[model samples]
Target: MPEVELLLRSRRVVTPEGVRAASVAVAGGRIAALLPHSAQAPPGAAVADFGDDALLPGLVDTHVHVNDPGRTEWEGFHTATRAAAAGGVTTLVDMPLNSLPPTTTVPNLHVKQAVAGPKAHVDVGFWGGALPTNRADLRPLHEAGVFGFKAFLSPSGVEEFPPLGPRELEAAAREIAGFGGLLIVHAEDPGRLDAAPAAEGPRYAGFLASRPRTAENEAIDALIALARRLEVRIHILHLSSADALPAIAAAKADGVPVTAETCPHFLTLTAEEVPDGATEFKCCPPIREAANQDALWAGLAAGTVDCVVSDHSPCTTDLKVPDFGRAWGGISSLQLGLPVLWTEARRRGHTLHDVARWTATAPAALASLGCKGAIAPGRDADFAVLAPDETFTVDAAALHHRNPVTAYAGRTLHGVVRSSWLRGRKIADRGTPLAGPVGRLLERA
Candidate 1:
């Protein structure tokens, strides 16, 4: 093994075993060893000593949208990954849609990867899209090294990426199962949505009513049944309705290969806090009431929810018009998810170890990135140096994302990321990304 090239000592280092005072030794861009916090650095090894700040495994957010190639105005890889680094995210898997080619085929996937290769500031991977007509592309794309396939049960907002009907979704799932590939879904029953009252005008209540919990519950129940029968691994994306927790838990107990993820918006923001016409808060599976948020937290603590990710979707400011009905539905918080999550997690008495699992370990496992996530030997030396007790008020314009628009605009958050290192190289320092893009394009390990 190569000699240690760098050493990081922290009073509180979050590791797979738990949080404790430790010194992490790094060599050849990977973790070499873990020792006591007071361990001395070997000859020729550079050292950084963090007295009381917590050193966490760099977060891995599996749900992010970087609309490059076709919609660079919305967000490109360069700015998006920069924001991710600033927020302590070391690795992210880009969503299939939103980008120009949509990643529905091998060629499209290659195009997006080519565009991202020169721009990403963090290690990035791709997810292929699953449409009714793209059935043949499933295995080929998976073989081409996409992490998984993403399918939507209802309208996908954009005309290019249409949702799959029940039969089409089943076909996609069955096909994915044959090849041992994962299928993640945007679960909202279109029938329930069509039956609900129209969400027109500026009222948040009107928007909330349009995406009822029944939609999520019905969709989840059907997915559970599908997983049980077809024996395919299905991941529920950005789950908002806590009413479906019991069914999800039951499915897990029954040994159905089903997992679910909720976004930071659902965990922190609430409909009551969203004023009328604040379209920035508008997203599909809309943020629910305070009680619903509470239930979601409880579900998270009880292990019913698998992980928390940022569905970091952003659009041009014009696309985010003031009216809730007219504005685009997405939230861009790649630059704020760490603090946003920590602020809420701490209040609930959750430890940094728990945060690391939800944001890093679970996400890495979900995507099957075996060599990343935890601060253990043989893993990439990805670390997020956080002042867990520090506080900061968000200023949208100060963020590194392409557009200065986010739902976390003015909120105060805890746990500021003082620095972030990817593969033993500092990518972000004092909430700013260092010059040059050091990220690499990643495929399935």
Candidate 2:
């Protein structure tokens, strides 16, 4: 028999089949077996019994922006992964932009890995950038093991990573398809947006109106058309507009090989709640109204939206100017995604299993992280011990991210994460000091 290293027993264990009482045995850093809840641990195995607390598969967030290397002041690997571990996220795929000398080439990727390799507290993977100038660098970067390429259809905020033109977009799509890789896009029509009123003020309404849903809808339509024409896989990132749902559903039904994701802010917060001058709530695709939030929920239930992730883009607090339009556009919720989503999801009559699927399973499937997302045998021994009934108010200063500028400052949330384990080792426990760096840099398999 294989040497059993650890055995975790829980009254509520979430398996792919269903939630049930079970004991998970781990050996060689992978799940060895699923035994009955009362099963005896092997002689040499370390046992952790979490009575009544739910044991869930660690979440896989594929849209995090750990802007390290050149942009460590914004958010670095140590801070970001520590925040991730605290939120029950064992694995995260970092977006390629925001960092200086973005991951647009193999050498740049190595630079990031060199900085992150020793500081990461959880498993980290990278996404390559699809800039107009990097067209020739795609395959080499793919072969170097980036999960996929990320491209923006509109101004990317950072001048170095320019938005791809229509011709450039199609060319990148064809190149990515040629290599059988995926292209994840930030879909927003620049033409419509430039024509729309410019955002400029402390008023939230002006910012909301500046980025109307039609921009997202038009971009999705164009992307769907491109995906169909090129026979490539495309993923829409941080989809905040509900009006694009029907088109996404239709395209998927016709087998267009496309998928989309939304963030916790889009699911929980609303335009109606955002107070004036609260620029911390600003993001690229502005959060819509409550009815639109309802439509987004419906889209999730209807399988139009594939997953939910924390687009945990963080910056210095000073950068979040009182002006909504001029402030940095991102939300810092890396350490709060689980509880925030759980609070809203439970209220909507959604079960923990549904949360698991959206937060872990679907993201894992999207990035092809085959071994990282489930509790089944042969999967990595990553788990989150969540106390479902516990509750806490959000305190931005207490968060693990480098900056204390979260939009969830005073919100109360459910599902407290007591501890998180990565590869059979405890990386985060509520009040205890975290263990040393045990995370590995992952490559596409």
> Once model 1 is optimally superposed onto the true structure by TM-score, how far is the C-alpha of residue 356 displaced, in angstroms?
0.4
Ten contiguous residues minimizing lDDT sum, candidate 2: 430-439
lDDT of 1: 0.94
- Candidate 2: tens digits of C-alpha lDDT, residues 1-445: 4789899999999998889999999999999999999999989899999999999999999999998888889999999999999989999999999998799999999999999999989999999999998999999999999999999999999988999999999999999999999999999999989989999989999999899899999999999999999999999999999999999999999999999999999999999999999999999899999999999999998899999999999999899999988999999998889999999999999988888999999999999999988899999999988999899988898889999999999988898999999999999998232977788999999
**What do the candidate models score in CA lDDT, each in turn?**
0.94, 0.94
What TM-score goes with each of the models?
0.99, 0.99
Deviation from native of the Cα of residue 183 in model 1, angstroms: 0.4
lDDT of 1 by residue, 1-445 (tens): 5799999999999999999999999999999999888888999999999999999999999999999889999999999999999999999999999888899999999999999999989999999999989999999999999999999999999888999999999999999999999999999999999999988888999999999999999999999999999999999999999999999999999999999999899999999999999999999999999999999999899889999999999999998877777889999999899899999999999999999999999999999999899999999999999999989999999999999999998899998899999999999999899978999998876
Give model 2's TM-score versus the native structure.
0.99
RMSD of each: 0.7, 0.8
Cα deviation in Å at residue 355, candidate 2?
A: 0.6
